[model samples]
Target: MVTVAPTYHVPVLLRQSVDGLNIQPNGTYVDVTFGGGGHSREILSRLGENGQLYSFDQDGDAERNMPPGDGRFTFVRSNFRYLTNWMRYYGVTAIDGLMADLGVSSHHFDDEARGFSFRFEAPLDMRMNSRAGMTAADVVNRYDEERLARIFYLYGEMKNSRRLAAAIVKGRADRPLTTVAHLTELVQPLIGRDRQKKDLAKVFQALRIEVNHEMDALEEMLQAAVRALRPGGRLVVLTYHSLEDRMVKNFMRSGNAEGKTQQDFFGNRLVPLKPVNNKVIIPDEEEQTANPRSRSAKLRIAQKLG
Candidate 1:
């Protein structure tokens, strides 16, 4: 039997995100994506005896990282999409702050069999929760050509999505694409030599996103974050992609449809939340050098307005 190494997820934007939460000493908080429990540990440190921290992680392996039992801390093994519902189950009506660090964890990518990283020659299985849904192999082999193209174009943002999809379709005619190495070779010729690596990463990213329904889950969780926070509560989100960052930015700025600042005929202020920073915060050069994954991270924060 091939023994799988224990999964180790490295939390991104650790200090900046926890600091942005502006945690109140005795206030309640939630870490929507408690991958390696790094941010959760930080939040727990800031909380007082009366404060409580509820964390969520879909991957069961994350439970292994949980801190020793503390009356003030609770960890739920579930996706953050059901954040609001799960919080209610825990008897939490509202919280003082919330944090979501979206996207796959380093542990997920590192597990070769999980197939989240292009570096490993593993089976095309990218489900964050292994038991729940379809795998990358299923999508690559079964999804129709048009649907495949759309997935690449929308999620991966690949310029040659159509051609790539066609290539995949043709390549799989003899047999289904079953592994990262196989798919990589099949699609390599479709992308120019100079841009092959980047294009492949994007394609894999799109597949992972779709396999996990990440964008939809983020949208749901964002709405839940807004609704579950009490007045004066904080929403701190760290996004690695433009789509997630844009959603956070827009939701923080306008706080309503039409992206218009809420106002009456006289133009009086009435926004639901106020942006803590007009621009997104990024990792400094030193930090990026230490952790390359921090290079693409963007942090945005807002405070719920009364």
Candidate 2:
């Protein structure tokens, strides 16, 4: 097991995910989700003197974990949505590999002021990049009941999304919803006590997905990664939710999130890359016992075609 600060975050599938990269000692690589830098550090250890690494994290807090005086490492203080833009600006025409662990770091949820978890009474501010973007409060309080219902239904996969949205709409009529407690209180009665935690997690997941524009940005980033990778380069992604996992799986198979396939007259499937694992990889009993949060993680890897 890799040694990472327990409080910041514990990397899931740390070895498996990095091994999937097929790291080249002298090749250029990017770690787009440099949450706790555990994976980044492992990648760095594998690189030779001439190799280069670009780690991206929009959150200012993540930068504090960078290894000092590392000549080959470059930290990009921007969202991974603009992966190609930043790579081009740095004169990097192509990269050998890219790794993105899309899970929200443990640090974010544990920090009470961030409002990423219902376990806290903090304000509804779940922006991954706190320096910009609308807070979760903005979405819950301002969005119409229909739009909010769509978010919960589509993103959270909630069966009672319409009812949940109606409750929020009615509850916030007297006063604006402002905090985690307020939102959970409004909707908990709509869910059974047996599934309160699971149902509430879905609510927060949907709001966080909307507040961060995660799905849209993920699509953009995945496409950018395809364009940025050199032939034979690898794309390794660790997704924490089904919404994003479906997008990644589809893209790997078809080079697009829609999962459409193109073929020539001979019926040969034309795709940009080949999927590395036929079945999605998940945590084993040992890892799950070590880190319960990693239970939902699904890892998928692909390589850019020639």
Candidate 3:
């Protein structure tokens, strides 16, 4: 709840994301990832006095950026995976729209102590919700070679996953890998200087995904999103990585993680969500230049049909 002078996070594709909600002045909405209050503040401005906004964020730093003294806004300090439970507790059964900007916030990368970036030497702790769950160090120092290889291959999409995992196991046996520097040194030789940063990012992405169980939470939250929204309510999600973008695309198209469309007796598709756009939206050149981190962002919008 401590407020810092520096910016907490920068919202990506700000205008496009908020506009995709198709806001109604008096309608209710939810910002599932309220990192900097940028999106929440924008929604508040467009809202009537009676309009409600519930912003959810598990990170402690996000609470520090809460919009001050806004009675129309309610901040929920919980992960969006429990969207249904929190909505019921607040006496809200349905919402007009929901927006989620997935992936790591800018604050994590800026704060070297968080260990989200390889640019700094810090403790290998990359938990979005730092108060709970396993850290990056735990995975690196503990997971078996096979499990490590699977995570690297599946999540990082690393081609040398087995070799990388074997290296980690061998390195850790001699001495525990506790900090970002230690892990980087162990793997840097395998990744060559030409592709150092890119390769390292992929490995870190794999560890972060495993530590946070991001894919599982995303699937659960998406299912809850379908049930939480009123008919015709919009769901706008901005994903930074390919895995996340792919999953979002499938869910929006099929209303299920497997991306299989169910058929009714009439042979009509029984999908809860209907895609609003035929193609995924990407940030324009201006945005990419201004915010280099937003280069990978892909936006997908959907509406609950039933």
Candidate 4:
């Protein structure tokens, strides 16, 4: 068992997700979200001398988790959206497996300075790549009310999205929504006490999604993964939210983002990848109780067709 930093919690269903790869010792693989290098390390353990692993993460913090001078490993310090580009740059024509553990990483939420959680009075700067892109404060303070509403509704799945957006717009008119405390104080009034914490988490989730362009980036990475994977290659992904899970499920089923499968004249379903599991895998109660954040995880696996 590999150990991680105190702040970076171990991923749930770690062995199961890695086992889904059906790893080939000499085959090349990629771990697109190497949050704490847990999955990357596991992949390395299963590989032979010639096996290669390219782990991608935008956060500089993740780089700290890289294995100790492994020749087989390469850390790509960029968003997984450029999966194909990075592969091409490395002169790699195809990959045997690609695994992605999607959603805001646990470490991000645990790090108060990152502004992923509302538990602390931190600045709303939820950039995975802290060096780039818009901050959550930027989204809340500058985005139009309608756009804000859509982000909350789509990303956060909040029903009171419109009202929440309106409140932010109105509140920011008086004082900019700059910190977790600032946003929480302004919106806490609108939510009922029973669902306040849950809704507030959603509110932060929406802001984080918009600030990071997560959905768009995920779609791009999936499309690239499809093209990069070789025949019989495994695409094991652990998605945290319904929207991303749906997107992964659809792409694997139909070979497109629309989930529309194409068939030949023989009526054979023409798809690039086949779902390895008919049912999505989730953490059992025992595991969930141990790590509450793993409760929402949905693990989906697919294999590229010949």
Candidate 5:
């Protein structure tokens, strides 16, 4: 038996997310992003013997954190982007509730070799699934300046995207940038003293997003969640960044890709999902004090409507 790390992961918004599911004792459920199985274990506690839980985690390391199986739980080692297809493969048509906690796992950040944290000088790798495509170095070194600027602007929402891109281009001209430290040094001067670290974080975030195709994966997962849910099933998502939160907010409100509000001839709304709460939920002071990473988290819940 793999000894679970004493400090594997502290799932953010634990109460909020599990409560958001409104779990039914005998009903089937899915935790699309099962980091450390924190929410999954909580959901299992409330489930009856017949109840079933399907959990998905793309990171292979998460498998080590899995609780001892009891035939009631199933863990799928794949991205949540294929939620619908995977559910079908398991002979499940519709789930009573679905929970997705989308953020970098604490394990990933703590493992320096994974290279997620800016605090460490490690390889530029940021692939959630190590088996997959290009690393962050490939993105920084190979992408054109305009493309880099666009990623930084759209994903990171960086204000000095042009300057940052230019700096990267210039820095890489002499030799290919191959590590997180290399990129950090190149962009820090362009960002200057005020908010320099934060700016560099944004740039790194953009690179990681582009390298992993996070936005596109999120879109695919959202669409799959909507289609796989029953009419009254709930879709609860916890997002840490504005880009993801915006997409979730719009999709829940409009039930369309464009996020445009729809109305019938009688001026009735055509939204297929209704927000359980009008406002997003943030971590309480207590939670934030315990886990700083929980500070930026935003939890949003919606119930699928006919």
Candidate 6:
């Protein structure tokens, strides 16, 4: 097992994901989710002296973990949604590989003030960047009950999303739901004692997705990944939830998130990426035992076609 500091986020499928990139010693690479620089470090180790790496992270804390005096690595402090723009700005038109480890990091959960975990009684602020963007508190306190219900249903996959949204709306009418505890208390009656934690996690996931605009950002990033990768270059992604996994899988198969292939009038397929493996890659039992947080991780690797 690779050792990483608690403050630095532990990367899932570290070897498998990086290896999937099929790194060329002098090729250019991008690690779009440079949370703790674990994946970026692995990529750097494989690079030749002439190789270049561009790692993006909107969180300021992540930059602190970057290796100093590394002339080959450039850290971009912006959301991965602007990946193509930044790459172009840096005069990089095409890259050899790109990797994105989606979703919240372990550091976010460890920091109680972030409010990513319901186990803590902190302010309901779950912004990954934390420097900008709306907080979870803002979404819960201000969004219409219908909008909340839609997100809970679609993002969280909760069956009782409407009831949950109604409960929050009714509860917050008395006062603003400013903290994690406030939201938890309002939803407690609807949650059974046995599934309280799981149900609460679902609601929190929905709120975080909405607050961060994760789905939209992910879709934009995928489109950008296709444009930014060179022919035969790899796009490796590690997704934690079914929604994210579905998007990655569909895009890999059809070059679109809808999972449908498009053919031209000349009977030629227009897909950009071909799956490295038809089946999803998952963590082994040993890795899972070591890091339970990686249990839900699904890795998908695809290569850009010429």
| Backbone clashes under 3 angstroms, per model | 0, 0, 0, 0, 0, 0
lDDT per model vs. reference? 0.86, 0.92, 0.91, 0.91, 0.86, 0.92
Superior candidate under lDDT, 2 versus 3? 2
Off by over 4 Å in 1: 1-7, 256-270
Please write out the lDDT profile of model 3 over residues 1-306, one tens digit for every residue: 213234976678888898999999889999999998888888888888899999999999998888778789999999899999999999997899999999998888889999999999999999999999999999998899999999999999999999999999999999999999999998998998899999999999999999989999999999998998999899999999989988999999998887899999999998898899869899999989998878999999999896
lDDT of 5 at 31: 93
Extract clashing residue pairs from model 3: none
Candidate 5 per-residue lDDT, tens place, 1-306, comes to: 223335668888887888998888899999988878888888888889899999998888888777785689899999888887899899998888999888787788788888787889999999888988899988888889999889999999988898888999999999899887888888877776888777777877787788778888888988888888888899999998889888889998998656999799999988879999888899999999999889999999999997
* lDDT per residue as tens, model 6, 206-250: 999988999999999999999999999999999999999999999
Ranking by lDDT: 2, 6, 3, 4, 5, 1
lDDT of 1 by residue, 8-109 (tens): 755677788989999998999999888887888889888889999999988988888888868898999888999988987988999999998887787787
- lDDT for model 2 comes to 0.92
Stretches of candidate 6 exceeding 4 Å from the true structure = 1-6
Q: Hey, what RMSD does candidate 2 come out at?
A: 1.4
**Residue lDDT tens for model 4, 62-122:** 8888888789999999999999999999999999999999987778888988899988889
Q: TM-score of the candidate numbered 3?
A: 0.97
Model 1 weakest 10-residue run by lDDT: 1-10
Tens-place lDDT digits, model 2, residues 1-306 = 323543478889988998999999999999999988989988988899999999999999998888778899999999899998999999999999999999699899899999999999999999999998899999988999999999999999999999999999999998999999999899989999999899999999999999999999999999999999999999999999889999999999998999999998999999999999979999999999998889999999999999
Model 2, stretches more than 4 Å misplaced? 1-6
Question: What's model 2's TM-score?
Answer: 0.97
For lDDT, candidate 3 versus 5, the one ahead is: 3
| lDDT at residue 239 of model 3 (Cα atoms) | 96
* Segments in model 3 whose C-alpha atoms lie over 4 Å from true places: 1-6
